[model samples]
Structure formats: structure tokens, C-alpha cells
Target chain A: MKVKQISVFLENKSGRLATVTRVLGDNGINIRALSIADTADFGILRLIVNDPDKAWQILKNNEFTVSETEIIAVQVPDKPGGLASILETLEKSKINIEYMYAFVGKSGENAVVVFRVEEIDRAITFLQENGIRLLTGKEVYTF
Target chain B: MWNREMETIPRPQLEKIQAERLRKTVERVYNNVPFYRRKLDAANIKPEDIQTVKDLERLPFTTKQDLRDNYPFGLFAVPREEVVRVHASSGTTGKMTVVGYTRNDIGTWSEVMARTLGCGNVTEKDIIQVAYGYGLFTGGLGAHYGAERVGAMVVPISGGNTKRQLQVMVDFNVTALACTPSYALYFTETAAEEGIDIRSLPLRVGFFGAEPWSHNMRKEIEEKMNIKAIDIYGLSEIIGPGVSSECLEQDGLHVWEDHFMVEIIDPNTGQVVPYGEKGELVFTCISKEALPLIRYRTRDISILYPDVCRCGRTHKRMNRVMGRTDDMLIIRGVNVFPSQIESVLLEIGETEPHYQLIVDREGNLDDLEIWVEVSEKIFSDEIKKMEELENKIKKEILSILGISARIKLVEPKTIARSEGKAKRVIDRRDVYTK
Candidate 1:
């Protein structure tokens, strides 16, 4: 299953992160999950949002460099070996993950793990065939 | 002195030779070159009418556009067989300003270069390294011939390769260096970085030219490299790197009056100015055969001191070239036109037209950073995409300008817009200069 994520480019100036979030918040767009990749010169803010298309539009209107990327969200058992098991399966299948982040689901027994990989369709087919639960975009957004 | 008789020749005798050479040069150009013949005819002046250096004012002035109009070989006075060498400068509009030299002309250049190197006290005992770039540019070979003429051990180690340049300077015990003043300072920094003690090296004299530098830069170079930094001035169109040079006195560069007739004219009015007045420097190549340029306007702004120098040279001297009437930036001895930068940006189609070039001196080296505005569509949130665009723009600029620059992409509206002509460059190094 694939989910839509919005990313914004921010120059490493003071209050740039605040500016990006303020722009999205002012447009009534809620950020569900977020991660930041930063360097000395600039930073990239990635967000799983309620409406990624609306978020991209509002950020673009605010003159922020924003893009939409397709990522997969997997349901884990919230155990110590949950992420390790999924990673092992992906490794065996020769699927490389670009980046990953996690959030605990409302059920408290499972976790939602977001992944960015180059081959989304192959990873989806492999993971589904391996009996790994892949949340749909609608389910991830609602969660 | 390389040639004591010529260096200290009396003013009257020098002027006499200048007058005779000027007459011969004008007569040759009038009969051979159609461009000069037309120019002289349009000015209603004949070659016989030019008997003295003072009579040169009556002739029509030649601009760089005239050279471009002539193109590759349109202004040569001699046949193609007699021409020995050719040099060119990057043209403003993508065509080169080409110049040629005959055997005798090369001899004249070498002679002037000998005098120039001799001014820096380069003797037969000294080991000289010519660090100026060789090829179609006049810097390297010009210094090479001059160093050889002085009977010095010449090392034809052209430009770049900082590590090798330093190693050669140490291993060969180089006593003299001929390169751009900025590069000499850059070498000093690199030597220090490599744990080499440049001050302990045998570098006694440094002949630096091909770009305008300040007296403070002279001090920096001398103290850092422990060498006597001498300023040498010339252009490819006007016989390359040995037109004039500062003697030991370091007051002004002595223009060998016997070969070149120098004049100062107000750039705005195009009229001759009094001696010691600041104006555009013009030269008439009295001894040049292949390219006998007459009243060729050198856009460099400086004053002329015809008085004899304290170093006992009776040749007329010109002050250091300070500013230019036009916008030509000399970055690390490379000629960079702002229009070239604009053309590269337009060709890449990644950035907006609004850009600013920030030039600064970082640790005695010239640092160039170009601030280009990116269109909203091209600005990518992905780090790899953004870095790719930056590298692409940098490669394009380097290929077009032949100079490296740090590419900085800013927001579209960050650069201030102008109502008239845009302000393209912010030179922070001007504070060190007058």
C-alpha cells in the first residue's frame, strides 16, 4: 500500500521550520507525522499529512519548495522484532529503503511504520505476498 | 639593468627614436592595412604628415570594436609567411580579439620582456619559474622568453597544480616567480596549508601581472611569500605581458618609449589630456611589424608620469592601472564578462535572470560566489534534485566562463530588481583597494 507525503525545502535560516508549519497550519492542513533531514546549508521537512495535495498547493503558494512522494506504511506488532522482521524480509527480497519513520497506532498493540524506497510497486507486491500487512492510503490518513 | 644604455637613455634621444619609429609604423600601416588606410584617409591625414609622436593625435583612434571588425587576420601588415606567433583575448561578443607577431615582432616582445624581468632583478644566477598560462594567451611564453633573454635559468612551469608548483619552487630553488599577483598570494596560502614554509624558500622576486592589483596586495604578497612583488602590465592585443613594468623604485611602471608611444586621453571627451592627468591609456606600437596598432585605446584608467624615475630610467612611466571605463572583472587572471555569466544562466534555463556575483578575497585568494534566483517550478524539495540543479548550473558556468564559482540558489524575489541597468556584482574586496 502507498501513502502520499509532502516535503518542503527550507533554507537553514532561523524560524524556517516554523514558517513552513505555519503556512500549512494557516491553510487548515494538519500534519499527521513529520521528519526533518537537515544539513549545514539547508533542510528538508517531510510530512505525512491529512490532505497531501492541499498541503503541497498551500506550501507552493507560500513560495516554499514542496513536492509529493509516494511512500508505504506497514502495520507492525509493536514488539521488539516487529521492525527487524519486516526489514529482514525486505532485505531478503532485495528491496532498499531510502528512509523510515514510525508512529504508534491508536490500538496500542501495533505500530505504523512509514518507508521510502525506490521501487514501490515491487516492494508492495513482495511485502503483501510475505503476509506483511500494508495499510492503504485511506487507512493511514484516518489513523 | 638588462640594457643600461636603453633603460637610462636620455629623454631627447628616446623621444627621437620614438618619433622615427612612429613615422615608420604609420607609413607602413597606411600603405599595407586597408583598415588603417581608410581610417587615415577619413581623418584627412597622410602617412608623411606624421613625423613626430605629437603628430599621432591627428590619426584616428582604434577601438576594440575595430579589432573585432577586422577579425582574425584583417589588420596584419605583413604576409602570412612572416608571422611567427598569434595571441588572443576572449571577446565581449564571443569572438576573440586576435593579434599576430612576426619574427622581429617576437624579438621586440622578448626585448621588452627582458627589460621587464630585469626590473625585478632577475639575473643569470636566478632560477625563474614562469607560472603564467601558456598558449594563445601571452602571459607564459612572454615571461619565458624574457627570463631566457636575461640568461636566467627559466622553468616553464605554467599555471595551476598548486602542489607541483610549490614542490618545483622548493626542489628547483626557484628565486623568481612570474604569475598573477592574486595567484602568488593563493600559492602562499596553499604552501602554508601543505606545511611548507614559503618565507624560507629562495623566492627573491615576483613578477605579477595580467590583472590589476593594489599596493596593499603588493605588501601582502611580499610579506607572505618573502619576495619583491613587482607589477607588470600588458595585454594580448598590445604585445602581451611586457608592455611596461615597475622598476625597483616601485613608483610607476616605465613604458619603453623607444618601442611604444604612450598617450593619455580623456575617456569621456576623447581628447588628449595633460601629462600626470588621469585618463585612458593609449599606445602606438612603433616597433611591432605583424600588428602595428596605432592609437589603440586601452580602457585602463591611469595617469602618465613622463618625469625620469629615481631608479635612473629616463623612460616615461605610467601609474598602476586602477579602474576601467567598462565592466571587465579580472578573476584569478581570467577575463570574466558579466554578459557571459548571463548567457550561461539563460542557456541552463534553471534560474531566473536576476543574479548577483559576490567577489571577495578569502585568505589572500579570490573567491567568487554567484547568487542565482530559481524559478518556483525548478525549486525541488528533494535534496538530491536541488543539488543536481546546482551542479548543473555550476558546470554550465564553468564551461562558458572558464572560471569556477560557488553556485547559490535563492528565492525568486530575493535579488533586488532595478529600474534601469541591473546591479550584477558586489565586489567586497574593494575595501582593500583605493
Candidate 2:
């Protein structure tokens, strides 16, 4: 499923992130979700965008390094044990979660959760084979 | 260590092998490369007369300009179809000069480079991270092929993106790196700024080349990176990064005499000086197939040592090059020459010949301040002429050379009076090092 996640190379410098974001704005690419994985010398900025290929193209053209990947986006009713149930299913399947993000749907009811799993295809297959509902690109993006 | 083909050859046998190769290379260049033949013809020397290594001096000297005039592949000894690879000097900033290699030439290059890396205790077990730029620039591919030939896992992380370079080093467990000394130093400094203790890194040795550096600066690098900083020397005009290298002894860089011949000659008298005497370094590529250069003037000032090393290798060694004899400067490890800046000014058509190259080492790096003469042609007396001239020269010089230069508009005749070969370079790095 399509996920709105941002991946950026994290340079520890404060303004370096700004340079990447400024580039997105200048090129008119909007960031839907963003997080950073960091080491001392660099950090990977993970991002899901409105235009994945164009966002990547804009960054690469400006000499900004970018890596693209697919992930699983699951929608759940905003109730108790919502995150716990998804976690138990992924945990049982032995799928490692590198990073994940959660947000409320614009309609203000269903919960949208994005996960950058270690094994993407297998993660989706396990969820599909287990009767867990997954969000499509249009559903995740529009919500 | 397994490929002991040329390195393990006995000294006397190596000499004989070189002599045979030298004579053939002389004859081959005379027959195939018209440029070398014309140069030999003008000097009244026949290729047949040069039978021994001693007779090599009798041939005329080849120079950088010769490479430029015979631009691209004119100097190649073989047909274009036989050539497997081409590497060029960024003579892109000057008149471009190119060099080519056959399959055999590339093998010899890799062997010599492996030997250079071997000097630093590198082996097949080490992962080599190549940070030098690839493509036409020889620094990247030169190091890349050699590391691969030596059986090391290589990271072809060509220059730029400091963050990615650091991440790759950590993520891949890269143990060695190759780049311009300047950039490597910059990487170390950037790492520190980010709270990265350099001692925590995996890099153990760095092969820095394509620029001039000092022993004192070498100490600084060794301290900063907590790794051995090995100096590797090469120019695209003369093979690539395998030309010569300094072993752990750090006494002098050992030149691969089996493939190339080395001589130091007095520039004024054009006479070969005895061993240990300082003079311009020259080379004759005895084993090069695509371009067998003969007595090519490197314009680098250095001396050679013929003694066998404690490391048990018998290859000849060259003292670390002091500096270039031409319009070259080592400001903070950057090769700054007047021609590079002059080209930019020429493109704009408002600069004059009167320019002083001012170089100094700051806090931890070298800085260049170009004191250029402001010609009235581009500036109207109505403006603050000096300020406008300063901005113009600064912008153009920075654009040409990625390094910034402090442009000071000195009034005509303000750059101290020089009588002889104009003292264009006033280096202040030496004082700071002391």
C-alpha cells in the first residue's frame, strides 16, 4: 500500500534539514509524513510525499540524495486496543519494524498507521493472509 | 602480496627487465606516436641509438603542453580500437590533457596501486571506500580498480555528499578511504562538529593524493582522524594514482622504477643531477601501451632513493615532493595555480597580468587571498573602483576554483617590486607549520 513517509539524509547540522525542506517548497513538493534516522555524521530523513517520484526527482536534481521504498499503511477504527492488535499481528509474523507513524483520518474517525517494515512485501502478504485490512494509495493519501 | 609479479623481481633482474622495456618503448613511441617521434627527430636522436636506460636522457623532454597540443588521444602508441580506458587531467580548468591505457596498462596501474596501498598495510581483507570523484577524473577509477584488483571490497562512493559518505563508512564497515587530502580533512572536521569522536570510526588508513601536503600537516591529519595518512602521488598525464607512494617509513615515497623511470634535472642547465640532489622530477613510461611517454617533465621537485627498504621491498623511493616548479600553489591542500584564476578573469575580459597569489594557513586549514591588479578598462572612475573590482575578481575566481579567494584590489605597482621571474606566490603556510 502507498504510504506518505519522508526519508531524508540526516546531517547533524540544524539548518541542513531546512535546506531539504526549502528545496521541497521551492519545487512545490509537499511532505505528508516525515521522521529522521540519525548518526553523528548524518541522518536519514524518512518522508512520504504527495508526489513520490517528483519529490525524489526534485531532490536528486538539486544534488540531494534520496532513497525510495514501498511500505504498508493500515486503517483501523479509533478505539481501544487498535495499535495493540496491529502490533500483535506484526509481532507474531516475525516482521521487524524499522519505523512507523500514526495519525487520525481527516473524516475524524478511522486511525491511519504507516509502517516502514524491514520486509515490505512479506509484511503486506502476512497482513493480507491474516484478514487484516490495508489502506490503498488513494485511501491513505486522501485521508 | 600474492601477485608478486613485478614487486618481487630481484633488483638486478628488474633493471635488465626495465632496460629491455625502455628500449622497446622508445622505439615503439617513435614509430606510433608522431609527437614523440618529432620531438626525438628534432633532438637528432634515433630510436635505435637509445639501447640502454643510460641513453634515455639523450631523448628530448615531453611536457604538459605536449599532452595538451596532442589533446585527447594523439599521444597514444596504439590504435583507438585497442584502448580499453581513458583518464584525463582536469586540465579542464586549463588546456585539457588526456591519457589512455590498454588492458595491460590498466593491469600494471592496478598492481602499482595495490603496492601503494600495501605500503599502508592494506590487504584483501580491508574494505576500501573511494571518496575521490569518478569519471574523467583519474583519482576515483584509479583507486577503485586497484582496490578491486587487490581483492578488497570497494565502496565506489565518488566525491560529494559528506553525510552519505559518513553513513556508508559506518553502515558498510568500510575500513579504508581515498580522496584529496583537503576533503578528507574537511570530513574529519565535519564529523567533530557533529559530536562524532573520530576514534569511534572504522577508518584505519587514508590514501590522500591529487594535491600537495606537508609533513606537519600530515601530523595534523594523523591526529584528527586517528588514522595513518598515506601520501599517494599521480597525475593523469603520467599514469594515475599508482605512480609512487610513501610507506610507513615516511622517509620518501617509493617510485615504481620497473614501470616508469625517474630522474631529477636542474631546470636551468637541463643537466641530470646526482642522486639525493633536489631538482624537477621527470618520468619515462616503459610499460605504458596506449601512451608510452618518454622523459615527460613532471615539474614536481623531488629526489630519489635507490636503497632497499626495511619493509623488505627493493623498489626505488622518491623524497616527498617539496612542491611544483610551475604556476602551482598548495593553499590548504588545494592546487591553486595562477592560470586557473587567470582563465576565469580572461573569460570576463577585464583583468590584467599583474596578480599576486597570497596563500596562508588559517586555524586548521589553508586560505588563499588573490591580490589582483584592477585594470581601469572594466571600472569607471565614478564608482568605488576598488570595491567593484574586488567583487568581480572574487566571484569569478570562486566560480573557477571551488575554493574561495579573498580578492584585494591592489593599486598598480602596489604588489611588491619584483626584478627576476616574478614572485607570483607568497606562501605563509610554512611559517604557521613551523
Candidate 3:
């Protein structure tokens, strides 16, 4: 299932991220998986939340600018070569991954790997055609 | 039926006057003002090229920075001995804009002042109370000289001493007043408090300028003082306040196009705006002998109206100035000027127009904040009344200005009052170089 991730734009003013996090926490929007890309002056907090649409609305109402993107969620066994195997499959499909991160499954039986890819729709189609099971957002985030 | 300029002759006649003036002025500049002659040589434009009125564009536009860079005396077209009257703008950054007027130039000034006074319906019997400051500021002398030229008895009450200002108005039976719009309101309020019979006072009209004011503000002043508030627009570089004045109809200030050529142009591109669009105002003073400025870029933003004015004077009128291009504060991609804020405050009724534009650097970007003094009687006796009034004012200011101004209702006169032109901006957004 495709889930939209909201990337909250934040500047690194001492407690800016904490203020945003506190604001989100106060609004009761649960963060599912989060990754931060930061520079000296500012940072982008990309979050997969329990209700991204609601969280985005809340942030926007507070005058925070939020943008969305689709990320690949792959299910891997709790074994060493699982990530390597997925990368090899993507290479075989000639799909180059831009950047990636791993989210340990909530129940720890497996890991949900997320990737920023050059072609997200084609990667999803190629994986489905190759019988590679993509993790359901519910299974990866709430299992 | 009311389409001709009573003062203006035919086009060829006007061109002949301009060419003769331009030739004499160019010769004067080439001989006396080395900087201007140098600039002309650099541009490969000789003094002979400026023989026609159409060649005005060939000359370069002078800027505020040019005045600052030259510091002083670098732009005088005539010798120092020939300069009879001198004035300068109160430059906050460096030096000051030094302007000179020869005896003939002063005559032109007085003549223009007479024309401006003609707009106000002043007769030789009228008592002119010139309340604007008399220093280097062009307001007082502009009105004073005009009153003198019109053969009216002059009371040169050069600004301040509001108590005496009222006293003379009542004592001398002053028929007309001239000052900045804000200070005029201050006088009205003071006159009201003292229970001085305003109706008994002979203030039939007021010539308000040096800062932008709105129709609502003018109406308020008119209603309070029982006088019509006519706008007289000018700057130090362009021979001051007599440059334009609103006729009795209050249509717009009619520019005295005979001695001066007025053009509105793109502030950045210097491209001339068509007759009806708003742009930066540029003035070419063709007649002044001491320092005739060729296309001096007055940073004030305005639009030219070539429409036939109801007044018999066919001189092209400029819409009451909206704001200054230089005074504009670009905040978060929004262009906000203090004049716009003042108009917003005035339109809403019962809001004091004391405002300071405060801009600061927040994080890596610029943050804008505005501090406005609350009107004397905001409904703030109860808690709910205070909050409600604040919200109302905030919403109104926001609706007109586009950017949300953090409205702070400081006590009256809390803004360091300037007897002359009020300082509108306090920008502190220096780029942090780390």
C-alpha cells in the first residue's frame, strides 16, 4: 500500500526540531518511522506517521510548510544478507536507489527497508513482477 | 469644456522654452559642474546633444547614492557665489543632500509656490499660517515663499510649539495651514482638548504633505478643523513642495510641468511607465540655475495622470503618492511600505497613525515586525473590549498590508516624535556573514 510521508521543513535554530516534535506530540499524531536530513542552518524531518494527512493538516495550520513523497517499503528477513539480496534484485532490474534507510519491524520478526529511488512506480512494478513481497505499511509500522 | 492648461502654451512654444533653458543649463553645467560634465563625457553625450526636449532621456538619471557619494558641492551647476538659497535633506546614513538655488531659481520656486497656492483658493486677503519647519526642510519655505508670492499675509510658524501654533491660528485669524499630515492631526487633537473654538478659528484650508496621507485622514482633518486638506507633494532634490499641489477639487496634485519634466519609470529597469501606471517618479528640473538635476530619480512611487483636470490648469497631475520605492520593506517576498500601513490605520477610523517598521534577521531569513501606537481612545476599559479591539485592528492591518503586522499598542507619543518628517523604518536585517 502506498502511504504518503510528510517532510516537515525545519531550520536548526537550537530547539526548532524539538518544538516541532513537541507540537506534533501535543497534537497526538504518532510518528511511525522518521529520518532527518540536516545541514548547518536547517533540516528536513521526513516522517511516516500514524495519520500523515491529519499531521500535515495540523502542521500547516500552525504555518509550518510540509511536503510529501512516496517511499519504497521492502520486507526483509532478520538475517545479514537480506538487505544485500534486495539491492542485487534492484540492480538486476536496472533500478538505481538514490538513498535508503532500514526501519526495524515493530515485532522484530523482520525489518522494513525504505528507499528513495529514481523511479518509484517502475521499481514497485518490477518487484511485484519478480515475486518480491513488498511490506504492507500496517505490517511494517504497526505489527 | 475644462480641458486646457491656462498656464500652458502650445507644444512648440513649450519646446522652445525648454530648449533655450536646456542649452543655457548645459553650458552652465559643462563650465561649472565638473562631475556632470565628466559623466556626460563618459557617456559620450556632449552638451550640444541636449538642445532639444526629446534629448532629455539621453542624459543620465541622478540618484540618492550619487548625492551621498559626492558628499557635498560635487553637483553644483553654478558657482558658489551665485547660490542664494541652499537646502539639504536630513540624510540618516552619510552626509546630506546639499541643494542650491540661484536668485532666478528662487524666483522660479516662488512662482511655483504661487501656482501651488492658487490650487488652495488663497487670495491676497488670506492669512497663510505655514506650520511646517523652516530649516533646510523644504516644507516651510516652500509654503512661506508661495504665500509671499501670492501676496497673502504670512505667519511662518515653522513647526513645533503646538500651543502657540493654535494661539496664532486663533489670534491672527490664520486662514490656511501647511504641515505634515500626522502633525496636522496632532494639532486638531490639541485644539479639541483645549476647548479652543475651532469653528471660530479661520483655518479654511490646509496644505499637507512631505509624507503620504489617505483620503480618510484628510477627511478626518477636514471634519475636525473645518478645512479642506490639500496635498502638496515634493522632495529636496526636486525643488521641494511646490513641485505639485492638489487643486480645490482634490483630484490629484497637478505637477508644474513647465519648469520640470516628470516621468514615472521602473525602479530597477529605468523603463518609462505609460501615462497611467504606477512606477518610481523621476524629475528633470530644466529651469533651476544653481543645480539643475537631469532626470533625478526621486525614490517616491507614483503614477502620472494625463487626464483633463477640472482645474483650468492643464499641467499633468500625479496621483497622490502611494509610497516610496526606497522606503519599501521586502519581507518574505511581500513589498510593504509605511504609507500603505498608515492608510490602513486611517481608513479603519479611530486608530492613531503612529507606526514604526521594524525588520530583523530571524534564523537565516528576514523577519518583519511593526510597532504601531494605539489611538488615544481604543475601547480597552474591559478585558474583552481590549482583546476584541486588538483583533479588529490586527485583521484590518493584515487585510490591507497582506503581511501580518504584530500590532503593539504603545502609549501615545511613545514613538520618538519628529517635528520634521517622521522616521518610518528601523531595519536591522544585516546579512549574518558566518
Candidate 4:
């Protein structure tokens, strides 16, 4: 299953991140999971939001460099080795993960981890063949 | 002096020579180049009307746009077969402003460049390292030919490779260095970092040009390297790097009036300013055969000094360039236009057209930072994709402009939006000459 993610380009200036969050918050768009990849000069803020299309629009209207990307959300057992187990499975299949971030689901027994892998279809098929549960876009948005 | 008789020719005789050469150049261009013929015809001026050097103002001024409109080989008076070499500088767009030289034209360049080196007393016994970039830019091969003509051992090291340059300087006993003034200073610092005392080396003189520098920069370089720093000036359109050069006196750059007729004109009005006034420097190639540009506006702002220098050269000297009429930035000796950067961004189709070029001097070298606004079409969640886009932009700019620049992907609306004209350049470097 493919999940929608929003990414914003942020310069390493004061209050840039705050402005991005404030723009989304004022528009009533909820950010579900977020992670920042930063360098000395600039940063890339990857976000999973409740309403990605609305969030992307509001961010674009606010003059933010935002993009919508399709990432996969996987449900893992709520334990210390949950991420390690899924990573081991992907590593065994030789699937490369570009980046990943995690968040605990509402059930409190499972965790949701967003993964951006190189080959989406192949990874999706391989993970399904290995009996891994993949959450669809709607499931992640409501969670 | 390489040619002492020509260098110190009397004013009246030199004017006579210039008038004769100018007349011949006008006749040749009129008969050979359709562009010049049409321009002269449109102005209702004939070649015979330009009988004296004073009549030069009657001719139409050729701008860089004219050269671009002609493109490659469009303005050459000689046929393509007779032209021995062609060098190009970056135009305002993607195309290059190409210049051609015949065999005799090359000889003229060599002779003038020899005189340029001779200004600093470069002789046959010296070992010279021509450190300017070689191909296309006209600095390296220009100084190379001159050093060879002076009967000196010419080490065509070109540019970059600081460690090897120092090794060759120390091993080969380099007596003279030819490069941009900034690079000469950079080399001095690099030499010290490597524990190579460049001052103790046999490096006696430096010929620096291609970009403008200050007298204070000269003093700093002279002190750092223990060498006599000389300022040489030229452009690709008008026979590079030997148009004018400062002799040992270092008072002002003595324009070689025998080959090039120099004039200071009000850039806005196209009228000649009185001598010793600040205006755009224009040149008429009096003796060139291939591309004899007549009254070509150089856009460099400077004053002309008509007094005889202490070096006894009778050619009128021009003060160091104070500024430019155009927004062309000379970054690391390469001509970079803001429009060129805009064209690059437009071609890439990834970033917004709004951008700013930040030019600053880091240490002794020029650093160019391009801040381009990231558009929605190019932004991605992956950092690797963004980095690839940055590299692509950097590579495209390098291929087009011939200079490396740091491509900074700034957020949209980060670059200030002006009301009328978007201010595209932020030059933080100190204005030392002014």
C-alpha cells in the first residue's frame, strides 16, 4: 500500500520551521509524523499529515517549496526489536531504504513506520509475499 | 622596452601612425565585413571620411550585443581559412562572444604581449610561469606567446595545481609570474601554508590582469611575494591582456597607442569626455586585420592621463578601471552576467527565475554563491534527489559560464522581491579601487 507524504524545503534560518508548522496548523492540517534531514545550509522536512493534499496546497500558497511523495507505511509489533525485524527482512531481500521514520499507532499494541525505499512496487510485492502487513493511505491518514 | 622606438614614439608621429592605421582598418572592414559596411552606410559615413584618428567619433560604437548578434565568424574581415585562431568569452546568453585572429593578427598580439611583459623588464634570461587559464579565455596563451617572444623559458603551467606550481617555481627558478592579481595572492598564501617561501624564490615580477584589482591589492601582493606587481588590462574582443599595462613606474597603464586607439566617452551620451575624466573606455583596433573593431565600447569606467610617465613611454596611460557601466561580474577572471545565470535557471526549468548572485572574496580568491529559489516542480522528499538537482545546476552553470559556483537551493520567498527590477547581485567584496 502507498501512503502520501509531504516534504518542504527549509533554509537554515531562524523561524523557518516554525513558519511551516504555523502555516499547516492555521489551515487545520494535522501533521501525523515528521522528520527533518538537515545540513549546514538547508534542510528537508519530511512530513506525514492527516490531509496531505490540503497541506500541500496551503504550504504552496504560503510560498513554501513543498512536494507530495508516495511512501509506504508498515505496522510493526510494539516492541524494541520491531524496526530491527522489518529492517532485517528488507535487508535480506536486498531492498534499500532511502529514509524512514516511526510513530506509535492508536491501538498501543503496534507501531507504524513510514519507509521510502528505492523500488516501491518490488518492495511492496516482496513485503506482502513475506506476510508483512502494509497500511493503506486511508488507514494511515485516520490513524 | 621590447620595441623601444615604438614604445616611446613622439605624440605627433604616433598620431600620424594611428590615423594611417585607422584609415586602412576602416577601408578593410568596409570592404570585407558586411556588418561594418552596413553600419557605416546607415550612418552616412564612408571609409574615406575617417582620414584621421580624431574622426573616430564619427563611427558607430560596437557594443557586446553587436558581437553577439554577429555570433561566431560573422564579423571577421578575413576568410575562415586565413584566420589562425579563435578565442571566446562567455556572452550574455548561452552563446559565446567569439573572436578570430589571422596569422599576422597573432603576431600583433605576441608583439603587444611582449611589450606588456617588457613593461616589467622581462628579458630572455628570465623564467616565466604563465599561470592564467589557457584555452578560450586568451590570458594564458597570450602571456605564453609574449614570454616566448621575449626569449624567456616559458613554463605554460596554465591555472590551478598550486603545489605543482610552487614545485616548478622552486625547481625551475621561475623569475616572473603571469596570472590574475587574486590568484597571485592566493599562491603566496598557499606557498606559505606549504612551507615554501615564495619570497625567497627567484620570482621577481608578476603581471596580473583579466579582472580589476586595487593599488592596495597590488601593494599587498607585492609585499607578500616580494615581487613587483604590474596591472595588465585587456578583453577577448580587443586582443586580450595586452591592450594596456603598467610599466615599472606603476603610475598608470600605458595604452599601446600604436596598435589600439584609446578613447574615453560618456557612456550614456556616446560623446568623448575630456582627458582625465571618468568615462567608459573605448578602443579602435587600428592595426588588426581579422576583427578590427572600430570604436568598440569596452564598458569599463576609467580616466585617461595624457602626461608622459616616468618610464619615458609616450603612450597615454589610463587609470585603473574604477567601475563598469554594465552589471557584468568578473568572478575569478571569468565574465559572469546575471542574465546568463537567469538563462541557466530558465533552461533547467527546476528553480524559480528569481535568484541572486552573491560574490565575495574568501581569503585571496573570489567565491560565487548562487541562491536560487526552489520551486514546487523540483522539490522532493528525498535529500539525494535534491542534491542531484543541485549538482546538475552546478554542472550546467560550470559548462556554460566556465566558473564553479555554489548552488544554494533556498526556500521560495526567501530572496527579496523588489518592486520594479529584481536586484540579482549582492557583491559583499570591498570596493578598494573606488
Chain B TM-scores, listed for every candidate in order, come to 0.93, 0.90, 0.75, 0.97
lDDT of 4: 0.91
In CAPRI terms, where does candidate 3 land?
Answer: incorrect
- Predicted candidate 3 versus true structure: per-residue lDDT over B109-172, tens digit per residue: 8888888887887878899988887877777888888889888999988877889999999889
Which of the two candidates, 2 or 4, achieves a greater lDDT against the reference? 4
TM-score list, all predictions: 0.80, 0.69, 0.58, 0.92
DockQ of each: 0.25, 0.01, 0.01, 0.74
Over B1-434, each residue of candidate 1 has an lDDT whose tens digit, in order, gives: 89889999998888889889989999999999999999889988989999877798888888888999999999999999999899987776567789999999889999999999889878899999999999888999999998888899999989999899999999999999999888898898899899999999988999999988988889989898888899999987789988999998999999977888899999988899999899999988999999989988988898999888999999989999978877778887777777777877777664547688888888767888988766655665456777877888789777766678998876545666678455888887772255
Candidate 1 ranges with C-alpha deviation above 4 Å: A1-9, A23-40, A43-143, B30-49, B65-71, B92-95, B162-164, B190-202, B350-352, B416-422, B431-434
Off by over 4 Å in 3: A1-143, B1-8, B328-434
Q: What is the lDDT of residue B351 in candidate 3?
A: 56
> Per-residue lDDT tens digits of candidate 2, residues B185-302?
7787777777666667878999988877767767878898888999998877779888998887777887888988888998777789998898999988998999888888988888
Candidate 1 displacement at residue A84 in angstroms:
13
Q: Is candidate 1 or candidate 3 better by lDDT?
A: 1
Clashing pairs in 1: none
TM-score attained by model 1: 0.80
Could you say which candidate leads in TM-score? 4
Rank list by TM-score:
4, 1, 2, 3
lDDT of each: 0.86, 0.77, 0.74, 0.91
Best by lDDT: 4
Interface root-mean-square deviation, each candidate: 2.4, 22.3, 18.8, 0.9
Per-residue lDDT tens digits for candidate 4, residues A43-111, read 999998899999999988887888888999999999889888888888888988999999987788988
